[model samples]
Target: MANELTEYQQNLVSLVQSHELGDIIKPLIKEIHLFDSYISGTSHLKDRSVLEKIAVGDMLSLQREDNKFDSNAILILNEDGKKLGYVPEKDNIIFARLLDAGKLLKAKISSITQKGSFIQVGVGIYLVDL
Candidate 1:
C-alpha cells in the first residue's frame, strides 16, 4: 500500500511536529526546602568540603520518618547516603503527602551557601517522570 496514516495518527504527527515538547512538559519546582540553623545533622556539614561540589541538579534522596519530632519530617540525603539535613518543617507537609500518595518525586540540591554560623542548602522538590 502507498504510504498512509489514519486521521488520528496524522493529527498526532502534526501536533508533535508543531509544538516543542520541552515547553509543554517542563519540570515544575514545587517546593524549595531551605535548611534552617536548627535542623539536626547540619553540624557535621561544617567540616565537610563536599558541599562545595554540590550542583544545582544533584539528586538528593528523601526518607520520610513518622517517629520524628516533626511528624512531617523528611530526611534529605546525598548520593553517597550521607545525611544532609531535614526538609524544613514548613515545606515538609506537602512533600510528605506527595510521598504518601506514591508520587514519583525527586529532590535536588538547588543552591548552597556558607553563612556566618550555618551552611544553608536549598533542596528543590520536583515531580518527575522517572
Candidate 2:
C-alpha cells in the first residue's frame, strides 16, 4: 500500500516548508482532545490546586489499566506522575488499543477549565513519525 498524508497533514507540511528565517510559526499540531475529563468519575477527586498549575505544552503520561470497568481504560498523569484522571470512555478504547499495539503516542496538557462543579482537562495526543 502506498503511504498518503491527510489533507491536514499536507497543509501542515506546506506551512512548515514555506517558512522563512525568523518566521514565527505556531506548533504544527494544535491542541486536540483525545478525551474529556469532566465526565470522568475520578476527575473531581483530583487536586484542583495541582491541576490548576498544569500548563499547555506540559508533557503527560498515560497508563493502561486492565482491571478498570473499561478494559481499555487509560490513566492520565502529571509530570510528577500523579494521577490526574482518565481518558474518557468515549475515546479510551481506540487510544488504549493503539498503545497496546506498540504505538508511540505522546500526550500533553492541551487545556484545563473549571466551571461550577465541572473540571475539564483536555489532552492532546501527538502521533510520532515512524
Candidate 3:
C-alpha cells in the first residue's frame, strides 16, 4: 500500500514541523511515565533543605543544563523552582535528546529514603502533554 496521510493529518504535521520544538503545542493526552531513578548529586545541592519539603506525587520540572562537565545534564527542580538534583549521568543522554527535541518532560516524586546522612529522592520521569 502506498504510504499516505489525510489532508488534515498532513496539515497537522506541517504545522508542527514549522515551529521550533519548544513552540509546538502540547498534545491533549495523559502523561506517560518513562522511567524511575534516584536523583544524583543531592548532597551537592546548594540548599539541601529543599529535599525535606518534597513528597510523593509532587510534580517537578526538568531543565536541560549545558555545562562543560556533563553536556547531558538535566536539572531537576521542585515545584517552587528550587534545585533538587539531576537525572543520573548514565541515564541522562536519552532524556537530553528528548528535551532537545522539544518534548515536554517532567519528574514526579516516587520515593524518598534516608540512608544515614544521605537522602535519596526517587523520581519517575514522564512525557507530559497538556
How does candidate 2 score on lDDT?
0.61
Clashing pairs in 1: none
71-108 in candidate 1: lDDT tens per residue? 87877777887667777787677767656555444577
**Sorted by lDDT, highest first, which candidate order results?**
3, 2, 1
The Cα local distance difference test for each model comes to 0.60, 0.61, 0.81
User: Tens digit of lDDT per residue, candidate 2, span 1-130?
Assistant: 4543222223333345366621444444343444433325444664656676678778876667766478778777777887777777887777766566554445776676776767676667654322
Best by TM-score: 3
- Residues 63-128, model 3: lDDT tens digits: 888778999999999989999999999999888877776677889999999999999889999986
Better of 1 and 2 by lDDT: 2
In order of appearance, the predictions have TM-scores of: 0.58, 0.61, 0.77
- Quick one: RMSD of model 3? 8.3
Off by over 4 Å in 3: 1-27
Better of 2 and 3 by TM-score: 3
TM-score for candidate 1, residues paired by index? 0.58
Give me the displacement of residue 1 in model 1, in angstroms: 58
Superposition error at 102 for model 3 (Å)? 0.4
